[model samples]
Target: MADAADGARTPAARLRALLAAAPADGPVLAPGAYDALSARLVADAGFSCVYMTGFGTTASLIGQPDIGLLGAAEMADNARRIAAVIGDVPLIADADTGYGNALNVARTVDTYERAGVAGIQLEDQVTPKRCGHMGGKEVISTAEMAGKIRAACEARRDPDTVIIARTDAVATDGVDEALDRARAYRDAGADVLFVEAPTGEADIEKIAGALAGGTPLLFNWAEGGRTPPLTLPRLRELGFSLVLYPIGTLLAATAGVRSLLETLRRDGTPAAALGSPQQMTLPGFDEFTELVGLSAIREREARYS
Candidate 1:
């Protein structure tokens, strides 16, 4: 039902609808996107939620990794642009490590709330973040992360804006330690729990089963981050509220673009691409031309008046 004219609609209303319309008895599939066009594509694909992946944003925008390079302002600016086009669809943004400590988390929450994200995931990795489920992964004391969780809870303007506390201590420390931190984080008022990078099936089961009772959970389906990938149904069976396919869109786009470039090199043009505007049907082109004609009529009327 969405169209170009619907651009002026507020994000909150659309977001609410998306949240309400998610599969009633099953886990939702949320895909990650970095920019506005990708966000729109995700929405158009009938995805109920769109995740603003930190990795994708870093790599796509600045050609970097999930390190601490992108600052709050830069991330917020990018979020605003994506949220602008996606019309809410419940954006679950990746606020990696809060960009700093507890004090920084307060500011991060304030700014992200203003950017109109529906939720945020804050991790326990002590700043200067390394990928979770990877070596050299370090975590702050549970007390420190709890303080940041509290800060995040206090900072949110909307009660519905979920704060997901991600504990990276599973890889850094023992599972017991990570569980301890998750308990403290939940007690500190996180709406969801993201226990990061649980490697094997047993670990995944332990994490999922342990958190299934009272808290909602999120699972990452990254290709090679630290954990193994599972199909959507498997994730749902494990009691995950959302499964984020963070890099699949980007990977597909990257491959397509690469192929297009190679084709252009070999041939004279990217001629076989059906996705191009050149492939539009006659009626489709006519409808597009009609819109232009309507716009020109409005412009002429405005000029005379």
Candidate 2:
């Protein structure tokens, strides 16, 4: 029997349920989180799910771009940490190129499954894959990517853990070929299809129309990237089952930190920065402490004493 302390459903189960129900209602809007704090905020704001973005994770962890700088271990470790804090909220993580080939893809899936992610997204770009929105991207052959997708599906212990197959062929190949690659991945047992960096509305519709039949489609709402921004309803109308805002919070935090630092440098204090309502209004110190579960820690400490 399962432990009484454990919830009735595992995180994977919950995420699967969410994905299954998404098509009927609308797209599942998952905002990306770079760290535990950001994930907590995302959950606190009442989002049903979170996406662990590799781009934002690279920037947050090492202050680097998403040019495949992170290894499988680093990405898995980051997912584990974020999963620890977000409670029951589902995390859909980016697994870039599955680190290597078919065997590597299996290991990547296993690591992410153990790390408590509900979904893992693997792209078709080469081992050292660049960001989907970036230029000069190249993808592996269709058969090779299909093999990795099959490997990913075979490796996951949970049947409910979703495997997303992202094809970056829209830039290297065209939208039509990207759609063809998506079909191959779908046939290989990918739970979701992501045709990355679709340039315009027509391409987006084409992707949705071609692949959104039995398999769910994922739309990358990468702000200021190659893809044009569309509203959630518009994306839903386009038949996308999941929409990921991969760096909205990260970008906001970047701008906020810069503003605060500039204010502090100019005034020799942060008070002026905090005074404006238009400026970032941070939670009070005590509230932030509570947000981080200081009260729970104190209660446990008292019980021990």
Candidate 3:
């Protein structure tokens, strides 16, 4: 839990401080959280930040894949909820394609800043963007994306609120095009650069070698995705500043739910599920109650009464 002084600071300010103070050798690791509960778990587990993954959010909310089904309002509302629950922990949210053009991009940035997100990731894919690792992805022109980046940067009320520009050109065009777009986005005032879904170690190295040291580089460690699962030390050595384990918490929670349902169907009790290490493990009842802030609620009630 964050102390009083930490809690008093704005999420954006806290995030800026964290970035400024982080060691070059150890990049900040932000785990994906699908909802308020999952975000709370991430915060309680002591992560420096929590990432609001559009993929997991789409799946959790609508039982659908992340093919840009949800609109800007839905994403912003989810970000507000997640930000509320995780006190003092910075939220880096995915603002897919900024929902439209430059004007729309500005509105998205404003809405996200008001939602208390510390970082907003804008990708170069079309309006209806898919997951970075998925096939059949297409990107807009470099000049268009650069304009959107400028819009996003100009729209933020808090200057410290990070504008992360992600280029998916690796899937559509090639690694060279992706690198060129990244440079353009960086020149357009993107605080962080995300070259999404590099296929191998060579691609990753090329990205770091080309774009690192000037602006922070973000690595998306999407589990079971196109990118190879590289270690933290390796990414740090490459000068990457952040790594997002998007969808890991969602996958873990999904597996736990499946196990519990299976145990109930087979044994007619949750007892066996809790008894084995291989089965679903849940926190104790009181432990979870406290984790979700029943203690704080009770304290407030007592003060009022």
Best prediction by lDDT: 3
Error of 3 at 76 (Å): 0.5
Q: Which regions of candidate 1 deviate over 4 angstroms?
A: 1-24, 272-305
Pick by lDDT: 1 or 2, better one: 2
Error of 1 at 125 (Å): 0.9
The residue-by-residue lDDT of candidate 3 on 1-305, one tens digit each, is: 23421643688877766665444336878999999999999998989899999999999999999999999999999999999999778999999999999999999999999999999999999879999989988889999999999999999899889999999999888899999999999999999899999999999999999986768889999999999999988887888888999999999999999998999999999887777554436776776798899999999999999
Off by over 4 Å in 3: 1-8, 23-25, 276-280
lDDT: worst 10-residue window of model 3: 1-10
In order, how many clashes per candidate?
A: 0, 0, 0
Instruction: Spell out the clash pairs found in candidate 1.
Output: none
TM-score per prediction, in order, is 0.83, 0.95, 0.95
- Candidate 1 lDDT tens digits, 1-305: 13321342545444433333333445657798988778878987877678998888988998877777888898898888888777647787888888888889989988887987887889988778855645787888889899999999898787667788999888778787888888899999987788888888788888888777666777888766778887777776887876778887888888878877887788876555434575632235556555335677878999999
Assess candidate 2 and give its TM-score to the true structure. Answer: 0.95
How many steric clashes does model 1 contain?
A: 0
The alpha-carbon RMSD values of the candidates against the true structure, listed in the order shown, are: 5.1, 3.4, 2.7
Model 2, which residues run further than 4 Å from truth? 1-8, 276-280
Candidate 2 lDDT tens digits, 64-177: 999999999999999999999998888999999999989999999999999999999999998698889999898899999999999999998999899999999999989999
